[model samples]
Target: MMIQMELSMLNRNGTLVSEEETEEVTGIHCENLVIAFAVSNSPDFRSIRIIKTIKMCSHCHTFAKLVSEKYKRQILIKDPNCLHKFKGGKCSCEDYW
Candidate 1:
């Protein structure tokens, strides 16, 4: 089954940050909450797809890549800017976005 989730904001240190704190907090960005949900609910789903209205931040992108590699699952994310296919600890965007 395919699952879609809303992103949550987190700081560089992995602490939850509020939306109002985003501007002043330079290192705050969205977190990959979908991965956690997928892990617990969809063991048979090897490939995952995510759609976001905004471009994914670097931290979330890296998290997705690492999860894909560690779990041996393929993750495809489509954002407003580009499509990121992550596998084997690498992303199709090559860290461009």
Candidate 2:
């Protein structure tokens, strides 16, 4: 994900809800993490949208669901549990957890 001011702010304030968004992380915490960035041509943004790919845990599946519904975004998460697609307030799990 793009390192926004939010990243530094969270590091300084220790208000980070999730360290999975940090840089140069090591150890088990660092495994299966992929962060990428892409820019949009929209005049309003003149900036890139950051994308993060960390292996989601079961709980983050819920988080992804909420985020997709709230923001109208597409999130395809790979986890030990399953591949999760959160789109249009719908999940691919079909009631399975």
Q: Pick the candidate with the highest lDDT.
A: 1
TM-score of 1: 0.70
For 1-97, candidate 1 gives per-residue lDDT tens digits of 5565654568789998654365336554433656767756787446878877666877788889898888888888898899999988999988997
Residue 55 accuracy (lDDT) in model 1: 66
Best by TM-score: 1
Model 2, 1-97: lDDT tens digits are 3434233225556775454655434222321222122112123223222333545554445655665565566655555556666676677885375
The alpha-carbon deviation from the true structure for residue 8 of candidate 2, after best TM-score superposition, in angstroms, is 16
lDDT of model 2 at position 80: 52
Q: Which residue segments of model 1 deviate by more than 4 Å?
A: 6-31
Could you tell me every candidate's TM-score relative to the true structure?
0.70, 0.41
